[model samples]
Target chain A: MSSCKFINTPALLLDLEIVQRNARLMLDRCQKLGVQLRPHMKTHKTLECADIMTGGSRRCIVVSTLAEASFYADRGYDDILYAYPLPFDKVERCAQLSERLSLFHVLLDNSLALQQLKKRPLSHGKIWHTAGVELTGIYAHCGNTYGCKGEEQIKAVAQQTTAITLQFMEKLKAIGIQGPKSSIGSTPSCSHPVPEMAMLSEVHPGNYVFYDVQQSLIGSCKLEDVAVRVLTRVIGHYPHRNQLLVDCGWTALSLDGGGRLPTGYAIIEGHPELKLTSMTQEHGRVEPISGELDFSQFPLGSVLTFIPHHACATAAMHPVYYVHSKGKIVDTWKPTRGW
Target chain B: MSSCKFINTPALLLDLEIVQRNARLMLDRCQKLGVQLRPHMKTHKTLECADIMTGGSRRCIVVSTLAEASFYADRGYDDILYAYPLPFDKVERCAQLSERLSLFHVLLDNSLALQQLKKRPLSHGKIWHTAGVELTGIYAHCGNTYGCKGEEQIKAVAQQTTAITLQFMEKLKAIGIQGPKSSIGSTPSCSHPVPEMAMLSEVHPGNYVFYDVQQSLIGSCKLEDVAVRVLTRVIGHYPHRNQLLVDCGWTALSLDGGGRLPTGYAIIEGHPELKLTSMTQEHGRVEPISGELDFSQFPLGSVLTFIPHHACATAAMHPVYYVHSKGKIVDTWKPTRGW
Candidate 1:
């Protein structure tokens, strides 16, 4: 374990203890609801983090990109679901990957996509000859829930998403394909007390593992539950502009705003008066809300921690994360990036 | 390099012919102005692109982060400038890197930063006795020019930036330092003609290689001058909702808006009627401006190219670029990423 003082500024830091706790809480909640939990690997793309989330099962996981799907498949993850609508040009690559995994599934929300999938022969014209490509499940992402105002709004969006998935499933059955499991969820819908439906076979929620300011404002988690932060340094102070520039900028923390929170971009850990007013490519501009900023409180070279507004977006920008446990660096994890 | 047909979706595609043209034009413009061009490599962090930008000189370049400075310095880039206010914690690293190169310079924008550098002994306590960590130059980024409405506004900000830089140089000289160069620039200021100041030694413009919607609106370049585009595919269509979802999202194009253009997130290469309304993590939602979108025109798997609002942010998202020239793949460049 290395000291925090030795770590570089503008680095991603993960609280391993909090991450494991979040994983266990989600797992226990899903278990209590008698539903299968398929952790989305899109948020934290590290196999080590996935191992903890899945309890080393490596059986089921959801990925946002084929690059991620191939990464986990190469490492022997059996059941992988590319959670987004399949890119038609990559159907051949999907077929090749399905041959190695026990099951590989993709999402379809519209009829045009279903028609394209029907025409595309999986496994080089081995249609119906072998289990060339298994349509493991049908899935829908209730992405609109991100814009929902409250629990009622989130539930309404979830219902609409499920109805759309059911209608799409009937179309699949009309084409002589029968009995495909249905999956629909987003972090907000899954985290809330969703009504149990017999049609739902799985729930996939990625960002609950490292809740950010967006999730907190959506009532999924508290501010204290956020497990990841960008550790930065106070570089320059502009008293006239009432701004203090930090090393962390849009490049490190991303440009995602605080979902429903009144906070501008991100919240400084322990300094509630500070507001991240704006950011440039490589400079974060922070200003005080009311009183004058005491520059002496945060001298040059002092480390300041910032919880991101969106964990997934922020995590995608970083290549490595410094994992800390019990106030010390315990491990390091490298995430697979790019398509 | 691979064929365009075989290249992956959401890939960074760089037209080498256009890039070289942009490079040549900027170089010629700087040459005509009789100002040295220390091209900022923060836009394209690749040795191949750097080679062309410097005209194979590999003598001087500007980087936004120390990691970039190290990446280029390790590969034989001698005169490298870490073109941000130096973080006090990294003074030792800057000093160590300076020892290996003919010149390694750091930027200072405030008196406090200068004082810290004065107190910090660089390279094994050679402060009082030897020439320790060298200040490459005084630099001021006219970042406010990005918000300027016209030539008059941009000129005012440029003058203010020059004034601040000159003021900082006097502070350096007062501390027994002398003869350090001064630089001040942004794409808007560098692209336009400014009053010749003897104090200014060089101009650093990063985004001229890939003029984007922002640059075009800023009157720096035309839309035809954009060199990089995100090659994506139409994956789904929703006629009832009037949305055509593509594979490129915020992760690929970023969330930067056009600086002064009326366009939304990004501009479709050949489809001006279509507007990228919003983006999810892996899906871009496009809508028509007035009439219904011709879904038949863009069938499933049809590739669509998009010019991003900010090229630097978009380019940073991709790991490799498919370089094209003369209607064929010419080479591939892998960009260095991370802190």
Candidate 2:
């Protein structure tokens, strides 16, 4: 059989060893800090990977979608925080899963979403009311570099949260809903978290898994902390035009521009100046502004390393991670869900 | 049972009826043009969708990767085109698959790719070589918006064809290979193609499937002919700030910046001045120029339409199509491959 046939080009291949090391590193870091680590499963959709990360804790998880919550819940993951704003249309699923699972939390940032959730009339005898209405949380995305840029902007989220909570309460009372949890998280803002503002429950930050290009640019993490890098092959060169093409395209990587990160296809590791500058569907174009390095070293089929813009977003684009220990494949992990 | 669950809030959804209509429309268009239609399967990876698009003909398909090639080929599609540049590392797969399938055409813009394809010694016998190489076609991507522009660039591609052919023969001889086919396509350069220059047998243009922001920018198709659009809901409003956040995000639509197009996000049908201006992971920020129109008319939960930049690229982002028939979902069609 042809080797590497299973590993298709334009497919995301993660280094599992790096991933495991990354996960364990975070777990240990959190253990030292004495903070409850609720690793976001959005970075690795595989149930197996989650088990490894949590060490079979069935511990709390931060999910980007209710579907993720459902997937993990089916796999017996009981405590989960659906960290995105509750889509008003999806409140029923939230209420239903909340009843079945030990704990399921939904987030709402705006009055309209809370109003929609309120529209789901809670029957007095429903099982959902018993397990916990208080478990439902609200997340206010504050100080996102792509949108709100500064500390001044972070304050805007606080102001907005206060206003939103008041309106949220009014709708809850109208629908006769009881106490719910309050929570907030934005990695950029959480570094200087207003814990009092997210006073009701836990904080969920995903990017701390593998800080990337946008994180480094936003000062959320240093360049050294980046754990994930896409291994790509250089295919063509036109020195006179100052360009080279790499095999990693959006399909192999992802299309997330990461809000306000330095805009480029990807950050070239080892060679700082050579960024994956532009791309089409199947090719990445790299342009270096400084001295002309010997691209011939990469030649027509040399592999290069890359740091993605958003680790969570980029991870969602790939199918499997090739777990490597010191650059040789040891194990492979597959994501459980992607659609 | 629970309603169909969308994994993520901002994920792409296909209205099945609209998708069917889209397939029918494209099929009819190609039939009228007297050109054999090969729908780029990259847009929709589902087997069900591919069956409808191919109209029972899976002999020739345009794929973006070997994963897709192998995927469809396993499902009985024999003729395939790995349309992107065939990297040196992948030539063996091409040669191996040629032994099984009737044909597999690969695109090549530079001589380096050909050299790499030649570098691999064929693992198959002479019969495989003659049949496979004869069926294999080369494509020139001399029409990138950033690439050599206008007639001069087009002529450069034509002039380079002689050298390309001579180099191809020399490389084939050097590597003991023969019979590779030559082809050229790039909508910008091949729309009114100079066929005699390169001895091209067939033209492959996937973007001609559904013209979008990029195609429109490049003057390929008019805005009215665009077949696909993302239907999003106005989920939030900072009315005083003149910004409305919609449900479509980089996840639902895509992170394509409309590359060299007049419009950034998808085009808003009736509102010519309105742009889907900015996007985050789950929110599309729409901005209305002062005194032009009040976008609050959309309010919360109102649906709006958007045309993507590159139809094939944007289509790859979503798993299903919202198939509409005169503004209502009549059916749901699931793509064959995806999460």
Candidate 3:
């Protein structure tokens, strides 16, 4: 690795053959849309890319943080799902990580968080049930982008995710608890879903794993299914202000003005009407509208891919993934967690 | 430790007593503003906070990544700077980290990067020097929003940094070169600088610690000298859309927009006339014009504080820095480099 081991030239160089062919084309499109794929380890938070997107099946996973459901439920990954919105001081570490995990999901959109998980204090099996307790399902969002949509906002978010999963199963059966089994999804209102009033058995959908530019302006996946990008390199060229600077900035692409869509930045495969208008902290001005492209022999550094409106917000600003092939770099995929 | 042994909770918690009181308050304000503190370990890229900001003074540092100047010149800290903007595929790791650092500096605003660092091949030993680089003077706009300012863009950036330091000292005395010394700084034109341009004896700001809301909308530090904030916690409550859902997202308060102000989402402390207005990853919508402050008793968990308009773009989106005090969480400050 010493073709120069400074290994941090504006860092982030993941190329495990295009992230294992973008994880086997999104795991064969969630095994041909049978659904229940789970993903969304906040997009590559890496447990070796979540064991290559869980082919070693701990199967079901989707956390946003309880430190990634206690790091894949302490690495054995017993079906997790913490997709954000449960806070009453982390309901006893989500009921002691649903008693050491066979399952421990959670999510909510308030009823005062089901009256603060119906007033805490019930994980008693000593140290929160020796580590295998349960309480699953209660998550909901299905209404992003300043949410709330038609059909009385998707039947009021499926009647508030079926009243916060029946108040988390009546406060886990008035304190008897036992988890795993309910959930929700949201690549912008579950890619056009509406009319299911929560009785969720499962549905996690992580931006289908690329579909960005604000999931194609909230129609969810369709600018040719995004799949992450931002290769970049064209070092500088300004011509007074026709601008060109690319070397990817905002720490390798992420000033996320939350996908304004088709406007400031987004070229994915280059010059398809160039955008990325301006950016600092390392430059990325771009702009070509319908002209300028000689770019002084373009190769000051070359490489220029871009196109991530949000592959999990640009693979959470990279920490390894090069995995190319058709273009070459070979292997390397690492992404455990980056605070 | 079992506080669920730490998992990606939107990271960045380095409060080792406010990072050693923000590194002894910027090395006692560059030893009372005489300037020459050197510090810019790309905003804490850890080697024990670069041995407490280089006290074991091999002094001078700036590195915005060459894997952090070869991890502090392979742990010796021999004066670095690489403040970014040198392309041509990083002139062979800037001529091999200026041949294993003794003083490695870098930063150029273009003259085809001093005609490609005077046709590359930089060195150090056997008296063969040549690679001490610098040149960032008149790139103004640390506040007019997106830089570049008056006095004819600072006397055409001081005549393009004195004709690229006399064409990089006549291509390092026609390639028989020698190294060390050459600098620049740009804390909004080095705080009223302009008088001595070339051989710029060292200076590199790194958001003078934390003066944001885009450096108080460009006049550089004012909002009580802003020093790294973003505590956030508010959970949820829409009270007919008065808004408040915060957990600080876009992955813990980043997505650096509003460099010229008015891009909204965070700035509410001492209520500078409160108004987060909108954000999402978790949520933050504050908007308290005037006060009656009860905000539903800020329930669901409370913490709130923000300052990022660019503290090295929110400290390169966190990895560690919880260094607080009086409010608690007294120690922990690591951030050498990540991605």
Q: List the global CA lDDT of all models.
A: 0.79, 0.61, 0.58
**Tens-digit per-residue lDDT, A190-240, candidate 1:** 777366433577888889888888887777778889999999899998889
Supply candidate 2's per-residue lDDT for B38: 59
Give me the chain B TM-score of candidate 2.
Answer: 0.71
Candidate 1 chain B, run of 10 with poorest lDDT = B124-133
Model 2: residues >4 Å from true position, as ranges?
A: A1-37, A52-55, A109-138, A145-182, A189-200, A239-242, A258-263, A336-339, B1-40, B45-55, B107-138, B145-182, B188-200, B258-263, B292-296, B328-339
Candidate 3 docking class = incorrect
Q: Which pairs of residues collide in candidate 1? A: none
lDDT of 3 by residue, B202-258 (tens): 445555444456645555445666556766666777677666777777666676764
**Who wins the TM-score comparison?**
1
What TM-score does chain A of each model score against the native chain A?
A: 0.88, 0.74, 0.34
User: Which is better, 2 or 3, measured by lDDT?
Assistant: 2
List the candidate 3 regions with Cα displacement exceeding 4 Å.
A1-63, A66-183, A194-219, A224-250, A254-270, A273-293, A296-311, A315-339, B1-40, B46-48, B51-53, B65-82, B86-106, B112-171, B175-330, B334-339
Each candidate's DockQ: 0.63, 0.31, 0.18
Candidate rank order under lDDT: 1, 2, 3
**Which of candidates 1 and 3 is the stronger one according to DockQ?**
1
